[model samples]
Target: MDRERVVEWLEGGSVSIPKVLLKHYADIGLNEIEFLTLLHIHESIGSGNPFPTPIEISNRMSIDGTACSEVLRSLMKRGFLAIEQQDVSMMICEKYSLRPLWQKLASLMFETVHEEEEQERERSETDLYTMFEKEFGRPLSPFECETLSMWIDQDDHEPVIIKAALREAVMSGKLNFRYIDRILFEWKKNGVKTIEQARNQSRKFRQHQQPKQGVSSNEGTRKTTIPFFNWLEQ
Candidate 1:
């Protein structure tokens, strides 16, 4: 809400963090400053640029440039922030949220990160639902619809990923509950239910198979090429 609330949340020490933000802190531990640095970047730019320069962010936050640089480096190492510099200004994107974790540590320090989305988002979600149903040729049950909606609403998954998962389930002769579950599981594991990931996985599997086959064939050829008696004599 306000600047004070935002800073408080970042400082509040919490063990359990939000799933979104957990990604950042999961590897290396993050402190109040590191957390605030991420929030500062988010306030400056909401997922606009994947990476921003430490100097720009420091200037905006009015903190020491050296301190900002150190924090940025820490964030990068911890996987909380990514860095990309162009000819012009450096861009930054908040990969995770520290608010949820802040709530756990101290509600007083908890601050909401995302403000409510614009009306256009709501309308777009409705349209996307309609399109999805039309494409599926069946009105999904309430539970199924909700699942799909959440997947769509949460920018985590792209529509293409869901479609790809569905397609893979169908083609694998597993167009059943088990198949769908497997697809979702894979999606969760790799955060990629997209067709591209699926195709890449498929390619990798084929490559793996080819190598095994090649190895087997080579062994067979080698066995034939040399006689057992010759080997014993040597």
Candidate 2:
């Protein structure tokens, strides 16, 4: 190609396509011809002609008019294209709408995103099981796994809060799943939904108990001192 031709092509601007269309064209059951036909319609719309005739599309794409018509028919049958007649300059002309195409594309993209999110969540839940097994020094039984799943799926407890409760139970010499469940239950009952909240509650509980422990220790000391004095009097 000549430099001038290349410069002209470069200055002609670009066609914008949705990333979802590029990645999932085949997944959405669109053949190459059908995809190209859609692109031509999109370009026509950009060029201020919302509806381009089959001949116009074929001329631009180097395809025969008959083949372009077949593709358009197929796309229409698949609910991706629609035709409507409009009055243009007192003459009836067919106008094509690509709204169904956009709606189908949106649905496919949403399904793809939801599937990815579910897969990630499963992987995270698996990792939680692995962490629990390592901490407990044994593999979880079927019942234990069921319990964990219930917490994740039914109770809607976050993994971080559950892990925090587990750590608290372990530190208190109660390293069993039942004890951990009890801790989580109590926290949930008290509206502790986060790791930070659980930690704060634990700190407050310890602080509340410390004064009573101190008083008990002081009373024991007084009793011992009194016994020692009575022995001296004897």
Candidate 3:
């Protein structure tokens, strides 16, 4: 196929089947025909036809109508499918419900979801540690680790804000964690919780202490000296 044609084919709209269904269909006691029937029903529902008749399913799957009906019956008997009637313009139309299948899938996925969340949290903690080590230029001590943990777990300081405070401290030529902690403490006391707030506070402090131009004693030369961290003394 030409590259453009291949790209168009790949980008075309398609049905989505849950990975759980594909991986655990056999474990859930479904045979090949039964699984395909479920997939067809799911696709029909996505296409705005909630319940496809046996003939429609059979035509799509190239199976005989009788065989398709038998597979559907087996699926319904096993509590994986349901057929209900709904009034559409005063005509009863059959609607298919896959609630049973979804409920079973959710139960199977609960532990997997919990494990993924734990993995994500561990990865975030590792990234935070790496960031600190790179900034501090050495491995963290046990006490420093405990302090980081306390900031995260006990004080509820977000890692992003802690990193921002560390950056602020570095810019002020004080790279110690203690100095960063004091910066965080001052920010919290002043209700500065986000990086933007910290930045605004810093800008206000700088503007408040911006030195006025003065004439030198001898030659009337203009002199200006910028003050740093003068607000911290307050």
Candidate 4:
């Protein structure tokens, strides 16, 4: 090509596509030909033409006009492309918009994040089940499993707090769900939503029950002790 022609080509400008759209086109259900056709439409819009004929778009692509027209129809059916008729100076003008495609891509990204979070939650619950079985020295009964699920799904307790409660039950020699449930209930009622808060609350209760110094064994066989907080008593 001549220098002038090369200069003109270089100055003709280019289409700018969002990286997300390019990366996730197929994930949003756009095939190769459909995506290419969409890009040409985007380019034409940036070049001051919101509406380009299928034949004109196809001339720059490998597909024929009929195939390009079908692709456009498919996009319309899939809610990815739309043609709007606008009144411009007493003339009706057709314009193509890809707003739906962008909206779908945005929803797809949200769903991907939501799916990952759900997977992580499932993994955490599985680990909790394993921990419970390990502590109890046997597989959880159906009722125990159901109770565990209820604690999470209905009560909305954090897994870490529940694990802390399990440790508290073990330390207190209360190896039963009823005792653990009471511990979790007491912690939640006391605003101990975190493991650290729960531990702090337990420590404070123990400290508050500290016994005063009394006669030693050598003097009168007297003893002193800090009382343990019985969650079941409450």
Candidate 5:
């Protein structure tokens, strides 16, 4: 690892993180020490060898073996490093750099305080794609994956919400990705994604329409029925 090259690399890029990555970084908020530890590993292995042992990194960074090992695992998860240890040397690669797509994800770990958020993102990104490919019997296009990422980032929308919206749109015979965004945008604005909120909204809407329905049951009943599960459904 060239100390000079490591320094140059760090200083060179503006670190224009992808939105998903930025969200992960902001949520995880890696401490300076952890970030520095990752940098050390990058320098120690730069274009030279695969993954270096914790002891080697510990010696160079002047840290304890245990501490270095712990941090190394953390870095591996957070996408700063990749680790593959076999009967031989461990292969490590930097994922957060301008690396290939596979390595890029390897270097990332969401900085979320809530474990649920971290798990949720992982589930949507990994499992959703896996399921999609399995069901369709074809891999999603890169652009399609990007669209999924966009949907995830937009509004902090979870897969559950997105999936529910998709089901609704499909059932209503209005399913379209573009429209889905608009629907989600509106749902988020109204704070009505959950079933309880939807139920509450339905009750209120029905209450508002009660008088009109009483006046003209024929016409008014149709309008009143529209909100039977308005909030919950859409």
Candidate 6:
């Protein structure tokens, strides 16, 4: 590799713009010419030239100065651009203000983040059924599907609560929907809304049953704490 070529390539400079702009340029009704113009303006601003002429912008784009000026005017009218006068060294100077564009871009960025989170949440919710089926080692029937949906929609149970209930059912050697539903019902009745609350309740319930339970092996019999919640008793 040639070092001078590398440095020269780096010296060609770069422009920084939000990823949201690339993904959602159409959302703001900006055509290729308009977007490219904005990029040039952004680059010029970054280079400390706040007031770049149409000729300067056009030199970097396919359009001429007249077309560039028209595009700039259009952007200003569309509420995506503004111009401001500022005192530089005791002399008033006109400069381009991209505050409106930045504001809109920021709004679009937030909207995209929210949209991505919603998509991820939906994916997790849909995966709950698959998790249950994998645990049970069988396909869920339509009635079972309806029951799960009822727990989520009608009962207003979050996925975490339902999953905790499922864990209880599995750990208790009672891998059935009824037992899971009973656990969830009891948790709801006792205000076990969060996963931590459910865990505390489970631990206390197991502790309460610890004294009365023992394990028998071929070697001997010994008293041991039950690790699973006895939801059947509740």
Question: Per-residue lDDT tens digits of candidate 4, residues 118-172?
Answer: 9999988999999999999999999999999999999998778889989988887
lDDT of 2: 0.81
Error of 6 at 37 (Å): 1.4
| Whole-model lDDT values for every prediction | 0.56, 0.81, 0.84, 0.90, 0.59, 0.87
Q: What's the TM-score of every candidate structure?
A: 0.31, 0.76, 0.58, 0.81, 0.34, 0.66
Q: Which ten contiguous residues of candidate 5 have the minimum total lDDT?
A: 93-102
TM-score of 5: 0.34
lDDT of 2 by residue, 111-153 (tens): 9899998999878788789988988899999999999999988
Q: Is candidate 4 or candidate 5 better by TM-score?
A: 4
Question: How far out, in Å, is residue 128 in model 4?
Answer: 0.6
| Highest TM-score against the true fold, candidate | 4
Supply the global lDDT for candidate 4: 0.90
What's the best-to-worst order under TM-score? 4, 2, 6, 3, 5, 1
Candidate 1 lDDT by residue in tens digits, 1-234: 799999998886544435556444423456767766766666555545434567777876767889898877776665555544344445433343433444443422232222233455566556656755665677777887777766766635655666665666555545443455456556567656557777776455445442222235655653222111111111
- In angstroms, the error of model 5 at 231 is 13
61-109, model 5: which lDDT tens digit per residue? 6678899889867766656556543443465343223233225444444
The residue ranges of model 4 lying beyond 4 angstroms of the native Cα positions read 1-14, 87-92, 211-228
Candidate 1 displacement at residue 63 in angstroms? 45
Record all residue pairs in model 4 with backbone atoms less than 3 Å apart, i.e. clashing.
Answer: none
Pairs clashing in candidate 1?
51-91, 52-91, 52-92, 161-194
Candidate 1 regions with alpha-carbon error over 4 angstroms: 1-136, 153-155, 176-178, 191-194, 206-234
Model 3 steric clash total: 0
Q: Quote model 3's TM-score.
A: 0.58
